[model samples]
Structures are given as structure tokens and as C-alpha cells.
Target: MAPTLPFRDINVHASPSHYAFSSPSSPSSPTLVVDRPSGDLRLHDGKLLGTQRVSSIAGILGIIKLRLDKYIIVITKAQPMGRLKGHMIYKVIATEFLPLRERPLHDPDEDTYLSLIKTLLKTGPMYFSYSFDLTNSFQRQAESDTSAPLWKRTDDRFFWNRFVQTDLIDFRTGGGNAHGFRQSLGQQPGMDPYILPVMFGMLEIKNTSIKGKPLTFVLITRRSRHRAGTRYFSRGIDEYGHVSNFNETEQAIILNDDSSSGLGGFAGDLGYQNGKIGGAAAQERQVLSYVQTRGSVPVYWAEVNTLKYTPTLQIRGVESATQAAKLHFDEQIRLYGDNWLVNLVNQKGRERRVKEAYEQLVKSLVSAPTEDTEADRVTREKFHIVEPERQKHELDRLHYIYFDFHNETKGLRWHRAQLLMEQLREPILQHGYFRGVDPPAVATESKSGTDRRLW
Candidate 1:
């Protein structure tokens, strides 16, 4: 099924009874109404009734309750970031909160809560797409079930509006039956016209041509909502194994191939059949994506800030740290296969303690003998298999490399950085990037012994 484009230009009509939202471009489009009395959402026949004020909004973000009043968050201004897979992406440039009640209660706590919300929205980076799932990478989207709606397919870790959009999601699933509404407005239950999922992170897209072949380079960094806070206030892994400031960055290249263009050289030699764009028989677009992630050390640790230039680092709970690291690596392996942990910290200094702790933690997981003692055996078995053979397998998959970046790069000797790259060359080659194309063409190229190496 084709994805439905969300309404970009929405006309919001505020009345004494309810607030009506309708698309200004489409007169026949169904209008979503939110009753002020009970805060119930229902569908209208694209007709404005008792409209006191009319305003144009980019899109509805969601609804949030601040003490005694509920406010509707709307995107006041948005700028186009770029397009991915033929879907236009937008970054929220500005936002406004419209109170549901005409005269909201003036509570001190409510004011504080509203101020916090405003500060968060103002400071945080948010991006969204009408039809594309911004929370997921291109490779993930290609593997996901396309039949699902964009809202449902979004990654929960980056879904910034998940908490506020609960009502809309519930309304979609309930089919508006409780409010005596039955019409779907020609949209599936999974797709809601009034619902927009926002992702919190960075998105950059550059359109350029290589050898006269047009292509788009996109960089997307998605931040996890879990354990997220200020640098000093939030550090280390939580009991649930969620690390602070966890983020996944994906670099993707999108190429639209056309046979008529007669593009030759770099673009023409992509190993497609007959040296053609897609294949000799079929012309198609190509997308290549590579994803990497960063997070705080998955251990029980903290850095206390005491109004000093450098904070005091403390490593806590060795037993709990082991358990947390295990959970963290397990999840990483499940998502991205083998993990190459490259730790770059000072070898001797305040940061030395952290580096040593991390190294010891890794050694314990990958080398410690299972028959040390009953307590030791029990602790290892509690987290996962820690037998010698199992530990050996884990050691092979989980590689640890520590490099003193500051010491090596001293005096602007950047050439020394190549030493680190040499160590990572093997693992990088083993785990190739994700590229979407015909399987038969790829197999044919492989059989022909062609060298299609990527750097």
C-alpha cells in the first residue's frame, strides 16, 4: 500500500465548545475536533462551527496536561530538511502551546511545569516526516513491514512525542467508537491525520553530484529518550542497562539512476548487470547506509560536578557493573552483530581510572576463570554463560582497543591516528555496510570475482 502524506497546512479553528483542525488545501478533507469540556477527540465533516478564531498551523505535535489544564502542542514553523526515499523531511523550527480551556487555572506548579516543557522544546532538536519514519535508519526501514503506518513503525527510543501522543494513538485504535463516531475518514486505524511523531536528534542532507551523477548524502543522529539528561546530572548505565546520552548515527547515500543520462565512470561501475544503472533491464534507485552508535560506559559509574573545571569520577558496584555491561553488550550484539569497542581516554591522569575500570570489566567478562570460587561462579552464571569456552567465543566477537588519543595526537601529529585505523581495518571489512539492491545482481558480481570494496 502507498503511504499517505500528512496534511502540511492545517487550519485550526478555535471555538467556545471545541477546537477544529482541518487541511486548508483540501476542502473535502475530514476535520478533527477536540471537545474542550471532556477533552474527547472526534471527527467533523470539514465544517467550522461557532469559530471564534482561525489560525494556520504546520501540524499538530500532540497534547499534554499541565496540572489542571491540557494544552495542544502545534508546530508553528517548520523548515524542510531534505527528502529521503522520495519523502520530504521537516525540522521543527518553532512550536506553540494552545490551551484547551479558554481560561486556564493559574497554579504555580502548573506554571513551573509549563516552563520546563517550553525550555525542553526550545532547546531540543526535533525532526519529523509526513510519510517517512525519521526515528529509523534507511536500512531498518527497508527491512521493516511497509504495510504498517509510519507512526507505528517509528523507533520508540527516538519517538519524542510518544508520551504526549498517547491519546491520539488510543483514539486510532479505538476507532472513535466510544464517541459515537464510526467513519475512518478513508484512512487506516494505524494512520491518524492528527498524529505526528517527532524525533529528537540531528539531521543533515547534502545534495551533490559525483562525476556528473546526482546523489544525496544524508547524516542522521537519533538520541535515545532513556536515561537522558544534562552531562553532569546523568552519567553511566542505569539498572535497566540503559546508558546516558545513547545515540545512533547513520550515514546514507541515495542515488537515483537514469539510463538516459549516460552516466559513466564511478556511478556506472556499481557492479549492476551489463554495467548499467540498476540493471540492463530495470532502472532503480540505490541506497547505501552505515550505522554506528555511542553511549556512556555501560558500568555503574558517576562523575560528580562540584563547580570545578573537571568533575570527580567514581566507579561504583563492581558486581552490578558486570551485570549491566553484559546486558548492554548483549543488546548491542543483537542489534548490530559483533561490537568493536574502541576506548580513547588518557592513559595517565584523572581519566586513567575510568580507562582502567573499563579494561578490567572487559577482562573479567572475557578471561576470568569459571572455577575461581562458588560465589564467583554464581555471579558469572547469573548474568550469562561465563565458562572458558563461552568466554572465548565472546572475546572473539567483543573486541576492546584502548588508544590514548591525546598523547598520540600531541603537537598536531595527526598522522599517528592512522595507527588506530590500522587496528580497526579487519573488523570494518568483516562487517560490510547495508546496501539495497537486487540479490541476483549482487550474487552475479560476487561470482565474477569483482572487487567492489568500500572505504
Candidate 2:
């Protein structure tokens, strides 16, 4: 079946954009600011847009337990979570076992799978999941929406001036058979508001290395920020790698000396002016030899083998659904467009149709309804979001990932996890970018999934 989502599920508190830091904490629950705009925490009005029941204990517990296994945790079916002026959100109850490898639960309209993978790796073996939130993320409907990048945190503690803090509830794993999901942060559950399942879902990948097991599926979630000129893009090195190669010759260096004064040690007066070197000094004279060297792998080249693509687009100048369709067709222009204004000259069965629809949609924007945007809609665009800011993006909630074994070491295996996390992060977090300020980078690397050859 085609993938679907419901956005209304998570806004239980529907808290305002700003929440104070001083608040009380429940027994096991995390802490939060008590002085919110309103008293309701669901963050939503008393309106149940739709209701469906999940017929499994795991599904019910998935919402509360962190260590629930992949098999036991069940989630409600995807549904429309919420909707604002420019976009819509879908929600799910949370599930344990996911769809088959062939059937991925990714954003059908965009490439969000890899971003989620990277988030999981960074907090690999997370003690347990923490309170989830999406305010601090660089969000967008698509990956290439490079409007306003939020990763440039004024301070590491704050993403967009929201001083967020979380209580680690303990990360849980479904324990395959007996593994049991029970992981926590350094000493206790992390008290950072941005660390949660969604954080794992928002990695903007650069590259990944696998091990004995092959990662087969790439799952990603959607984001909340979408604005005009959003230049969204994401990449993972399938063939090329970001890691620099090691130098066979430029190994560690050690200093040695043979000629010393009489006492070798610090002496006074005319000390050791005529003496020879000591046994230690003689030993130092022995030429330095290579102990070992880490090999080099061409990052650009490695990217080729593991190459993957995430769709990118902008939401500007689009009035009607037809315009949206044309923008979709125009993705090729964003990817392959090389000359200036030449993209305007494209023609084909699909391209022609999409362009036609987009032109029609542009006409509708003239008389669209009016709704005051909360903040400067133009400024809320997301692009090139940084490492931490991406954690709060709604799209970073992927839990099920498969790693295809293609000759990767355990360290490299862990690297794959990291790659999956970073790649899921939004690129160029600006809304204007989606409006075609820049073309998304093309897939230049290979996808052979081989050990990167070091230079």
C-alpha cells in the first residue's frame, strides 16, 4: 500500500513556541516549564480529529515503555496528525515490527530514510529514548529546502533561541529474542529535550560503512518547517567517503640526539661540556621506524560506491496543486540543470505535464486565503541544519533500519550508524533555497559499497 501519515498524534500538550525552564518533574517523567501559554499539554485543542484502535499490547506500551522490542511494540496506523496553512502532518501510534524490507515506511513524497538512520547511529545503543519535541529542528517538506539553516547555534544549548532540556526516560531495544531494549545516557536518562526517537530520524548523512550485516532499508521522517525558497538537499556517500586517507610515509615522528654534555641531566657551571652521550641517548640515536599507519580512503571516491539520493524542492511561487506537480517534475531541473535559464527550456511527456500544472498553480497563489503566520514565514525556512539542531526535526524519528553487509569492520559498522544519523539532517536550512536559489548536488559517487581505497 502507498505510505500515509497522520500529524495530529504528537501535539498532546500543544504547548506554545516558548516554554519556561523552571518546572516540577513527576516520578519517572522528565521535567518541563510549568508556565506555558495555556494549561493543556497535549498542545492541541479538545478535538479528536479521528480515532482508530491498535489491537496489540505492544502498540499501547510502545507509547510508554522504552525497552520494548521491535516485535512487541505496536503502533497505530498512520493518520493525519495536524495541518497548518502551508502543510499537513500525519501521525502514528508507534509500532514494533515494521514493514518488509521491500516495503519501507518512509515519506513517499521525499527521501527521508537515510536521515533517520544517521540519528540512530550517533546515539547508538541509546540507553533509552527521551521526551520528543520538534521545535529546535531545521524542518522542511523536502530535503533541498535551504531557506534558514538553524545548525548555526548561537550556543550549543540552544537551537533557535529555545533553551530546551529533556529527561532521559531510558532507551529501549526490542531485544531481538532476549536482547530487551534498556539503554540510558551516560549516567542517567539525558536531560536534553532534543534527544529522542525523532533525533535518530533526522540525520543528514555524509557517508556510511557497514559490517557483517548489510543495511537494506533506509527510513526517514518528515519535518515541520516549510517555507518559500527552501533549498532542501540530503546526501550519503555510497561510493565516496568523507574520511581522508592515511599517509604510508607520514607516520608519527620522534626526536633523538646523540651528543650530550657530561651528566646528560641538567648540570650546573661547566657541566658535561666534554662528555659523550649516555646509554639512553644512544638508544635515542636509533633511527625511528614505522610502527603502524591507518590507511587512506578517498572520500570523494568512496561516496561513489555508497551513493544515495534524497529528493529536494521548494514551495515558493506555487499556488495550486498543479504548481506542486510541476515543481515535482522540475526536480530534474534542480538536479541536472547546468545552464542559466536553460531549465526553462525543458520539454518531455512528464516534464511538460508537470510544468503545465505548476504554471496553473502559480495563478492560484494570487487569491489564496489569508492566515497570519506565527513567525516570519520567510525567515523560518530550513537549510543545512547543524548536528544538534536537526535532532528536533519531526523527520528524524525512524526506528527500523537495515544494514546490508558489504565488507565493513565493526568500527566501520559503527560509522554506518553515524552516517545514517548525519545524512538525515536537513541541508541548507532555508526556505528560499527550495525556491530554486541553487541546484541540488548531483549523485557523482558510486554505490558499490566497497572498502574505500586509501590514497
Candidate 3:
């Protein structure tokens, strides 16, 4: 079923451009100031106030957590739009806010209001910015929590401004520039916000009790941010040839209440010390990870190079297409491992040949690496073609994903059918190289479910 999102569903929207920040004049009068084109923002309060030069366009978005108290969220960068190499360019954006109260009550409506405010801001010409995250203080506090890994702060690459200072904003009246508006107001450090892709909406879930087991159906929709724009108006292919509006809708089912375990340590750690000693400990925490990916498979094609809305599938050559497809699956195998399911959305009889080619390609690529003979065999054995008859049961595991490339529903913003094709792909966060390290040795889990040495 198409999942319905809550009012707080996280979707990316262009932020408002007009709002700016200024020093607070009085206890009652707060002022807003816009930065000039010269990229200068001054802190006006005393004690090193008017000292720092903030070379970014930013402004206050609004006050959140209003039910408990008002916390002002400020966008530090003003007007994210700028030009690069004579072509319009957009980069990541930064944001920081000060909380008013020492301890504000947790308001559930905060997410909903935040989404609404961002949506309203998108009505104007605002693009060319990546994401906004709170400054350093909140990040330290967020990373301090061990119980909630999901809430833990990730690496700085994901943050637009990872090096922002504490005294960037000069707070008047309440306290010095180093502290927030008031030092006694019980202000906490900042936490970076997860800039959910504009393609996906807020988190949604359904609860049910099947037999005696508690079950949860969670749906996460991921839309591609690359070259994503209005219907027909924006080009479908990016400069790098990646397609636009490729959405990956993930449906995950949990048999019980358990947090998803993660690989401990930094982002690009190969089989590092996760506190657990052997493969058995890791296997014990596996938690039935059954996932499927259905999206525009890696095919060497582009649409933006031509004037037509849906440019012809510019297949460079048969060999190039195969190479692209191979690179795509190579990354997938590394990230998801060999066991996850693959469903290439069959497009009538037109894609039959492509499907056959892809199937053969996966088989050839999966088994080809003679450098690691045992690993190659294991990879080949792990991936198997799903039989048509049991396709439903194969999908009816702890996770189920349905991918549809409905040409009718998605009219050809490209073709005669004004239909737009959305491919349900895995999050790009899943696929990143663990740089400066050799491929770690494979550790096979034992059938006895005991500890097996990973490295």
C-alpha cells in the first residue's frame, strides 16, 4: 500500500531567502538584518561582538518548539544562490539557532511546523544549497549518547558547515557573545539535522500483532536530489548523466522491538573493533535484515544533453553500457553484500532484453573475480535468481519492497505519456568507499551460531 506520511514527514524544500539576523535591540524588540553581497555578517553585542566576519548568506527561519518555549532557528547563510564558472552553482548550506529556555518541554508538533515553514520558503527562487546543520556544541552532546546510535552524530562530510564556531552569533542583552542569548537560560549544545532528501516524506509505520509476534511495517521513500526539479521544466539527466526523480521506496518490517545494530567506529572502517570479538557476536545482532532494491538500474544513458524533454536513450555502445552496469552492481554487492534481493522493474516487453542482459551480467560479474576464488564462489552462491512462483514468499521476509515503473501513472514529462518514472533505489548513504584500506578478509558465519573471527 502507498504509505501515508505524517505532517512531520521529512522532505527537502528550498528555504526562504529574505529573512536575516541582527542584534537584539531591546528585551522586547528583536531585529532582522540581511547580509550584503560582499558576504559579511557582524555580531553587534559587546565582548568581541562585531569582531567575527561570517562570509555566508543566512537568516533566521523561525521559532520552533513553541508549545514549551520559543527556540529561534537561524539560517547562517543568506541567499544560497551563486554563480560558478558562468554556470549557476549550489553548495551545502549551514544553519545555527539559539534556544530561549534552559529546559524546554518536548513538543511533538515541532517536526510538522518545521516542514511547513520549509515548504512555504520554497515558493520563491531558492536552490543551490545542500543542507543546514546546527553548530558544534549540539553535535558534541548528540555524539555523547551511546544508547541511541541513530541519533548519534555522523561524520562532518554530511554536514554543510562542520567547523562553525560557538561565538559566531553575538547575543545581546541576555549574555556575552560566547553564550547564547542568556547564560542562565539552560541552553544546550546544538545537533545537526538530517537533511532528508526532498524525494522522501516523513517517517511512517503500521503496527500489528501477527500470531504472537509484534510486527511493524515501516516505509521510507527516497527521491534522488540530483537534478530534481519541477515536472517537464527541469532536465531529467544531470551533467554526470544520473537520472532525476529516481525514488527508492523502502518497506522494512521488524518482527520485534529492536534497534538496528550498526558497524561501530568511523564511516570508512573495514572490519574494525566493534566491541564484539567474533563473527558470531555480529551474527547474533543481525536482526533479520531482508531488503530489496528496485530502481533505475545502472545503464549508460542520458536525457539532458538534448533539447527534447525525454531525450533518446543515448546508448554510447554495448560494451560501455555493460561496463556501467557492472560498476553499479559492484558497489551494490560491496554495500548490501551478496544476499539482498534485486528486482529490475520490467518495462513491458521492451526491457526483456535488458533484463536478460542484466541477469547474465550479474552472473558473470558475481563469479568472475578469480583473484579471490573462494570469495567469488561464495558471492555467486549468495545471489540466486528468484523463482517466479515463490517470488511473493521470497519478498515476504522481514522486509518487503514493491517497485513500479508505471508509465501511465507517470506520464511522459518525457514522452507521449506525460508519465514520470520513479525508481526505488537504496539510499546513497549505503554506498561509500572505505578509503585508504585494502579489502578486508571475509569472515564466514558458522552454522552453529558461535563466534567466528571476522579479521
Clashes of each: 0, 158, 27
lDDT for model 2 comes to 0.22
User: How far does residue 176 in candidate 1 sit from its true spot (Å)?
Assistant: 9.3
Q: For residue 104, what is the lDDT in candidate 3?
A: 45
lDDT of 1 by residue, 350-429 (tens): 87777767766766777543421111221221111122335455543566666666766678989877867776687677
Off by more than 4 A, model 3: 1-34, 40-202, 207-216, 227-249, 253-290, 302-314, 339-349, 356-455
lDDT for model 3 = 0.31
lDDT of 3 by residue, 1-455 (tens): 21111111111111122223333222222223222221122222322223333323233333344444444454444342332111122322444444444444555686566556456444422222122111111112222332332222322212222122122222111233321233432322111111111212223445565675445554434344444445433422333534434443434443332223221211122223564322322222221112233334344434334675554443333345555544444443443443233433453444444444444433444432121111122122211242222223211111112122343224443342221111112322333211211122322321211111000
Computed on alpha carbons, the lDDT of every model, listed in order, comes to 0.70, 0.22, 0.31
Measured with C-alpha atoms, the lDDT of residue 318 in candidate 2 is 27
RMSD of each: 7.9, 24.9, 17.9
- Summarize candidate 2's per-residue lDDT along 281-313 as a digit string, tens digits: 222211111111122111111112224373332
Give RMSD (Å) of candidate 2 vs. truth: 24.9
lDDT of 1 at 116: 92
